[model samples]
Target: MDRPVNALSKAIRRRLGPSRLRDVLHGVPLGHPLHPAMAMVSAGCWIASAVLDVTRSDPRASRTLIATGVGMALPTATAGLADWSTLHREQQRVGFVHAIMNVTATGLYTGSLLMRMAGRERTGRALAFTGLGAVSVGAYLGGHMAYRQAAGANHAESVSHLVPLGWHDLCSLKDLPNGRPVRRRLGYIELFVLRLGDGVSVLADGCSHLAGPLHQGRVTVEDGDPCIVCPWHSSVFRISDGSVVHGPATAKQPAFRTRLRQDGVVQVRPAD
Candidate 1:
């Protein structure tokens, strides 16, 4: 599977690399992965068709639903593939099988639609029911990946909750290098600290998207505002406020407010 999956992954990267289209597909604009939301359309249509079938409703309505679902599969699958390509190998393996099941289900529904048009109503209905079963399995795997595996979850949401509600000493201002990002321990949570001239900025070291270390990432200026690009997956967040400048990461990195004491010790507390 690695050979083919790796090849397909490379192809997808080549096509969507660093483009707004890739960001759209990745749900960067939406602040969550688009695949799960897009999938609901196709899945809903098919499920509705199944309900119509169970009730022995109008064949035409069922046929239309099946066709609609099949038509929507292409875009839905494309969005899923885009996210799948960036996931870890374990998640990718599950996603690969999930995609196969959906493809098989789509094929079955397409055949069902064609058969109905050819006047073989019974065979078409049978195929459609089978397709629903296949899609159900695919949906189950999708849920497993999302809920159990946490493939697309925000990994840094626990920062504020985990940190005690008060100012904590970070480091002395002189220990930090000017204009360079560094990691510092603040109780249990790691912090990304950057000092420029007399001012200091701090953000959670773990990225909100996938726990990628922001301190290890490179800094760049976007629209004249400083931003940090995740070294793991290239998620970009504004340094000043930890807002997402670009994603794959929907949630902002937990930003911290900082102050310098008269003794030049840096102190930090979770920003409101």
Candidate 2:
């Protein structure tokens, strides 16, 4: 089993370079994985069509719903391509199966749309039923990717819940210099600590976009306010409140509350 998996991995690595796969998987602008969103859209369209079947809607309404479902196919294709580009060998094997199922479903919908256009009511209804059934199966596999495999899920969100409320000794106040972002590790958590002239600020070291290391990022004061720019994707967060001033990141990084101890040591803890 291991031999086959290793051989497959090498083949995939040669076909899709590591860096190229990383870019697609990262979903740079949205911050979250694109596949989930596309899945939701596809699911919503099919569900709406199922609902429309029961209601004797006007011809215009039927056309609209069908159009929406057909339009959703574009993003579904984009998201699938992005996810497939990044999958590991074993994951790719599973993903290929998932993709084929979804493609079949999409083809069924396309056939349904054409039959409707041709005024073949009975045939269109049959095709829609087939497409709906395929969508249900595809949805189950998508859930497996999200919940079981944890693909495109944020692992770092669990870190804050594990730590105690009180401050832990980070480093001496003088150790971190002004205008520089330093990397510090606390257990499994890596932090990016920045020193200002009067105070210090800290954020999770990993970029929420693709887990890009923030320690190597640049510090620039945005709009006369202190904020740091992530070097990899340029996602910016404010120093004072840890709010995301700019994004690709819809979710803010976990910020740490800091204080200078009497012994000139700086202590840090996860903010409530």
Candidate of highest TM-score: 1
lDDT of 1 at 9: 76
- Candidate 1 lDDT for residue 95: 87
Q: Write the per-residue lDDT of candidate 2 for residues 32-76, one digit (tens) a residue.
A: 666677677766876777667657555455556666877887766
Which portions of model 2 show Cα errors greater than 4 Å?
1-38, 48-64, 74-104, 133-141, 149-152, 158-160, 229-234
lDDT at 124, model 2:
73
Name the 10 consecutive residues with the lowest summed lDDT in model 2.
17-26
* Poorest lDDT segment (10 consecutive residues) of candidate 1: 13-22
Give the runs in model 1 whose Cα sits over 4 Å from its true position: none
What's the residue-level lDDT of 156 in candidate 2? Answer: 37
